[model samples]
Target: MIAGREVAGFSDREIADLLAPLRPAAPDSTENATRRDAFADAVWSCLVEPGDATAGVLRLALGPAAALVALDESDAVVERRLTDAGVPDPSRLGLAAARARWAPRAVEGRLRGAFRSARVMGVRLVVAGDPEWPGGLSDLGAHGPAALWVRGDPGVLVSGPSVALVGCRAASAYGEQVAAELADGLVSRGFAVHSGGAYGIDGMAHRAALAAEGTTAAVMAGGVDRLYPAGHHDLLSRVAARGAVVSELPCGTSPSRWRFLQRNRILAALTAATVVVEAGHRSGALNTAGHAAALGRPLGVVPGPVTSPASAGCHRLLRDGGAVCVTSADDVRQLVMPTLDLGGDAGPLRLPPEQLRVLDALSSRRPRDEAAIAASSGLSAERVAGVLAVLELDGRAVEGEGGWLRGRG
Candidate 1:
């Protein structure tokens, strides 16, 4: 039982129905254990708000089932359990504060309702261990989502390389045109496009990608079933038919101001890079850029006319050296996959075999000494040093205080 509700018969039936679409053909003897964990994760999705680090820590220290059980136990027992699970200082995790925050939303009836709604809507529950879960999300650590409620093909979330194109909802004509061109060119180059599924730049991006016959995913601020911004209901439906429409919240939850900001983090984490097509000084697209930079993902911005207020935020990013200036799909591609060629009329940006190996060995987050890079790329220190100099000049790599690191390009 979970949250004082029995997990047998009715509850089990609903969970099984919701997860049926994602289950593998090969049956396992531990089916009951899998069901229990899935149920616990589903309940966790409803109990905590998006990006709750304390809850993330709890879920990490104890498995979802054990974590849920700890909620009803005494504080002393909970602390002891956390200690046993290798937490150095359980009190530092703010267990009291988390418990207070979660108490009001711990209704078992609501939990069951979310499951039924998902089942009826054909939404599948995807947890951390699932094959369909995107690997990039692990970077968010404890602040990552507990689970994802997906309304379309879960596999699309992990498909190939993807870039997020975002901007203000009230985009200008110039901004929309730029977004559409970028999306079309990116999809033609074999990249999937991701966006917020909003009206302006986001809508243009999704539509262009679809028109080009490429996969595109929309990360929603509300529940997949709610499909906020009702005007884009048909657009989101088309995206779901071809790709995926996903959220961290359970079914029936409405989009709130805070939730929209939290949703930006998922968009940043899900893609290899984030490109702000156009944004005002306070546009929410800038919020997504911040999250991408924080995650060590490459951030690109399209520069608009200096006189245009719609692009003030983008110009700020460029002037501050926080993001690379990307005017075309080729530029955005280099930001995410620096090793790939630009192809087409621009010709391929080819590198020597040795240089390519060393470039591949470079880390974007950690700086590596020449010797370490040499060892990884199977090259001598002398050859590595020479290649590093060329890469640095090309803006494909940088020499940091620690050693060498991948550049944003």
Candidate 2:
């Protein structure tokens, strides 16, 4: 075993006392959480950041307890075990590098301090074996959390189907309104609302869920004890009281940019589907939508005015067929609920009314000259010429010896 892992690992008595909050409050309630599982998972959670698939693979190959013991092994031993476990590493150097990252955080004191802080802050830990762990998160494969540091009822994570409402931080009023209404509607019908508790659309969604007396889970980038955006402290506290404020990080860990990006995956994974209310061409919410798509979770986007830059990302998703256009809660429901029609095409293609009138002037069966078609369609000759050219390019109009007519089906 490596130098300190044997001495640095938490003892059973220490772990049992530190993780008592994770156990069921009811005397007769059945839950399998134990000191060994909670402590090892907590050690791993602090050892790696969110979405560390390497840690996940290790924990799975040798259960969390054995994995903790193995972390103290030589780099060669860990590497060989990883290789035998079928983790891809053409160079066989990934485990060695991961050792460098994990070594500094493998101390038992730091692990104990995290649990102690959580106890003082009323935070609870939940591991994968717990019944309260959201099953939807298993879809993350090797990127699933090592353990969850949560405030509020963990049961909320497992209860009912959930929808993620995420978008830009500087969302427009229209975006916020749409997000709130969507949350309200989904919650009224028994869906829990989920989002990162950011300012604009995310805050709107959470507040709406609360207003509707529905549960909402906020997956934080920082530790649950250290709520990042001070502005939303009260809101998040309410969520923790009524629902959940959860993270993979231990107490005292602050938020970072990379952590924020990685955090999007949990928001995507914990829900049945994701809806991006409004986002810029480069919004982080697009990252969440991408994760959802990668997980095969249904992704929906609300359309914005053609002029709004805030909605550009959503429009891009629709145009690229990365998301289905969803305008209402009903549209979102169709994504997760069964016995619903495959939704219709997205927002209408913006076309000039005069162009439609001009196109209408030409029949698929008959053809007419520009002047005649212009007179029939109540358009000037110049307008008719431009419209016909555009229509022809779009395969909506065809020109022949007779003149112009609608294209064939």
Candidate 3:
């Protein structure tokens, strides 16, 4: 029993029915244990929010079923169980705080409702050991999702090589065009595209990949049962028909701002690389890029006109040496398959080390005189002047009345 309700009330027959979509061919001998574990994971998906490291630790230490039972035990017993399971420091985990956050949603009705909604919507719950699970997600460690709610062929998620194309929701025409071209080109080379199911660049990528008849998955912030951005209903439906629409949350969960931010981590972890096609200085896509870099996944960006604010984030990434400049599908392919040489250069701008330092010192919004540029870039004045001249000839920088700024190329 848990949260004033008897666990026995949720019959094994009902649990098996709810999981039928994912367990079509399970052997009878192992079905009981499999059903119990899957049901526990489903309950865990409801008890904690996305990317809850504490919950992840608990689930890993106790296993989903034993962890759920721990919620009903006294704090001392729970801590002992954690210790017995080899947790490094059980007290530091703040079980009391975790329980406080989880208590409100621990009702049996909530669990039943989630399962009911999933069964009605034909959503499949996929736990970590499932064959359909994406192996790449293991890289997230304790911050990864405990289970996934999927609405299409879960096989598409584990299919071949995948790249994430993410950017600002309010993308410009040029941004959308480049996103489509990259998506189409990557698909033709046998790569699945992944993106958030949002408007602008994400929409363009999904549409282009589908037009090329390639697999593409939309990782949503909300429940797989409720596709957010209502306008993309038909598009998302089409994606679920051919690929998958996925979320870490269970059915009936609504999308929130925090959930959207947490959702970006999953997108970064699920693919070999992430590309920021277009982003403003404050675009949320930068959040995804940060995750990719932290995970040691290759990050790529598409450069836009220097004067366009829409490309400011991409420029920032390049200038900071946080991402590689990739303008074509071949360049992206190289990122995923580093050893597969494509003959000559893939056409990314390969500036000299000194020139790149000078470019990094130049500001897009504020002009800096040669002495100031030299000081910031840690280069000699003579070298700075020469590099500035070469940059000017290449339309990479422009001198104004007082100083030089990044060019409008």
The regions of model 2 sitting more than 4 angstroms off are: 1-8, 25-34, 83-93, 338-409
Instruction: Evaluate model 3: give its TM-score.
Output: 0.81
TM-score of each: 0.83, 0.79, 0.81
**lDDT for each residue of candidate 1 in 303-380, tens digit (9 for 90 to 100):** 999999999999998876547788999888886667665654342344565665677567677788998888766678
Off by over 4 Å in 1: 1-18, 21-30, 344-409
Error of 1 at 226 (Å): 0.7
Residue 47 of model 1, lDDT score: 88
lDDT of 2 at 401: 98
Best candidate (score: TM-score): 1
| True-structure Cα RMSD, model 1 | 6.6
With a 3 Å backbone cut-off (N, CA, C), the pairs that clash in candidate 3 are none
- Global lDDT scores for all candidate models: 0.84, 0.80, 0.84
Off-target runs (Cα >4 Å) in candidate 3 are 1-9, 343-409
- How far residue 92's Cα lies from its native spot in candidate 1, in Å, is 2.1
Say which prediction, candidate 1 or candidate 3, comes out ahead on TM-score.
Answer: 1
